[model samples]
Structures are given as C-alpha cells and as structure tokens.
Target: MGNLKSVALLLLFTFFVLHLPFVESDWFINYHIHVTNDLPLLNSPPNQPNLFLHCKSKKKDLGERPMVKGQDYTWDTKVNFWRTTLFFCRASWVGRKTIRFDAFVADRDEMTCRHYHNSCMWSVREKGIYFSKNNATWGNMYPW
Candidate 1:
C-alpha cells in the first residue's frame, strides 16, 4: 500500500509537469487608445479631413477608430498574451499639418496593462502631435 501511494504521487507530479506548457495563464492584457482631434476644422476631404487610429498584430488589423474635429475617440483592443502589437494612432488626412502617433506595445505588465483607462493618448494640441500615458501629462511626439 505504501509503494502504491508513492507511485501515484510520483505519477501525478509528472503529469502536471508535462502539461505545464499546455496550461494557459489568465494574464489579461489590453491597450486603450485615447484619440482626440482638437482642431477647429478638418481640411477638405481628399486633402486630409480626419485622423485615423488603427492597431494590428502580425499585420492583421485588430481594430480602428476615426477622430473627428472637436471631439474625443477612445478605442480598446486586446493583445495576444505577450505578443507585440503595432499601434498606428495617427494618419494623414489632408497635408503635413496633420499630427500622428505610431506606438508599439511589448510583453510587459507596465506596457500591456489589461485594465486601464486611457493607457495611451494620441492627440493634436497647438498644431502638434502629442502622446501620453495619461491625459493630464503630455509628451511631444511629432510636429504638425
């Protein structure tokens, strides 16, 4: 009986060890993109009338949002556990005066925060592109 119990314990331990890789961890990770266009007026269509926010992984478009003049747009997207994602928060609509931010998120809790409001910000301020972890603080990103 003692030998049988020892054998069972050993087998259980081996089973768990072998299946460790198969076990998926519930490490939730997501990125929130807060997009804003403070412009009073967008350039004429075909000349750059709007700013686009797009995110993707492996060249696949996960989701996107468009920022119009005088309003804020927030987009949320899930990140594949530990997979790098490319975030294109700004795109040209009319001319060189447009502000855009292209950001990347890697496999880190600080970088891949699953639950956070406005993890990143892409906005146009004073005719310039700005990025920030929060809305209260801003960092110069690009020239308008």
Candidate 2:
C-alpha cells in the first residue's frame, strides 16, 4: 500500500510539472502586436506612397502588406515553450530606404507585454518607429 501511494503521488507531481507552462493563466501570456502607419501625408505633393511591410517569425510569415497613412496591421502570437520565439519585420516606401527590425522577441518583450495586458503597439512615422505599452503614450524605439 505504501509503495502504491508513493507511486501515485510521484505521477501526480510529474503531471503538474509537465502541464504547468500550458495552463491558461497569467503565466502563459498571449501577445498581440499592432503595427500602424502614422506617417503624415505630404501637403505639397497630393500623392503619398503606401508603406510596405513584411513581417515573419521562424515558424510563420505574415507576408507583404501595404498600409496607407493612419492604417494599422495587427497579429497575435504566444511565446513558445523554449521562449525562443522571435518575429522580425521590414518596412519600406517608394523613395526611402528599407528599415528592418525585430517586431517581437520573446525574452525582450515578455515582461513589457505581460505588464501592459499582453499588447505591443508600434507606430511607423516619417522619422522612425515608436513603441507603446499603452495606446495612449508612445516612445521612439527605432529610427529610419
């Protein structure tokens, strides 16, 4: 009887340990990333170029997308078990140089996204790209 109880308890503990990371709680956070084109329209030139974006991760590619001023693109993803998930993006316009950046890095963005309700917001402007924890405030993170 004693050996049977010990074996049962060990199995229970093993199950808990193996399933802990997959639990649906704050410990397992799902992140939503929003990339917006906040570039201002040129008043002198009535025509404005569309912003082209290509974002990808090791397992997934978001494909190339175009955004006009004030438009936004959004996606959601979860950090992998190994915590090595990373997403990168490239942005370009008609006449400007292409800008490349890491959109999501599991180790770097986990805490910030966890703190801000699991949302990472980015704004692309004429000068550079900005990051926001909350939609209300913005900070410059990358420059063009």
Candidate 3:
C-alpha cells in the first residue's frame, strides 16, 4: 500500500511539472496611438468626432475617449485566445460620415526567450495610419 501511494504522488508531480509550458497566460499589453497633424483623416466637415479605439479583446466597449492632434492615447487590453487580439479606431465626430481604420496591434509570434517590449506603437502618417509591428510599408493594412 505504501509503495502504491508513493508512485501515485510521483506521477502527479511529474505531470504538473511537464505541462507548465502549455498553460495559457493572462499577459496584457499597452497599445499607444499617436495622431499626427501631417496626416489628415478627417473630411471637409472636420467634425472632430470623439476618437476612440475599439478592440475585439476579452472585453469590448472599453470606453470611448476623444483624441487630440499630436497626442497619444494609451489603451490597456488583454491578450485573447491564441495570444492574438484585433484593434481598430473609429471616428464619427458628427454628421453622417463614420470611419473605421485598422490600428493593427497584435503579437502572433510564438513565445521567445528574448525580451519583448510587450507594447505596440502606431502613428498617424501623411498617407494612412501605419501599424507598429508591421513594417511602415504602404498598403500593409492588417486583416479586418
């Protein structure tokens, strides 16, 4: 009886040690959006709609906030399943015109030993807003 109990305890300990790497993480990231005056996303009306970024994170509708030109807004969001999260910004300052642009903030790569900034940065440019993780190349829009 004593021998059987010892074997059971050993197996349990082994399983716990081996599966630690497969466990999912609750790691979160801080995403920053920098709006620039050089790139004008507004239209003729320029209603200056309340600028807010929306993400399909664990919790959507994280609250909306107005954006200021030449300023940055930081949003804290959780990493969804498969360690991926989608984000985009919306502008409906006023009138009937509404726009949704991709912010493209995510980390899809596998976990690595190297230290990662754990933060994604986006900047509004003369052309369209550019993604941080993706190279600042033209027509490099993230999936919708």
Candidate order (TM-score): 2, 1, 3
Candidate 1 per-residue lDDT over residues 1-144, each given as its tens digit: 999999999998997686554333322535666657665553445334365555455566646556566556665656554445555554554344444456545444335333345276666665577766656676776776
Candidate 2 C-alpha error for residue 81, in Å: 0.3
Whole-model Cα lDDT of every candidate shown, in order:
0.56, 0.81, 0.46
Model 3 Cα displacement at 35 (Å)? 6.9
Regions of model 2 farther than 4 Å from truth: 1-27, 43-49
Instruction: Using lDDT, give the best candidate's number.
Output: 2
**Candidate 3 C-alpha lDDT tens digits along 29-107:** 3434333222354563344533444433334654556554454655555545455665666643333334566443345
lDDT of 2 by residue, 5-102 (tens): 99999998997788775555434677999999877666423245468889999889999987778778899888886778899999885466579988
Error of 1 at 112 (Å): 8.7
Alpha carbon deviation, residue 93, candidate 1 (Å): 4.3
Residue 1 shift from truth in candidate 1, angstroms: 22
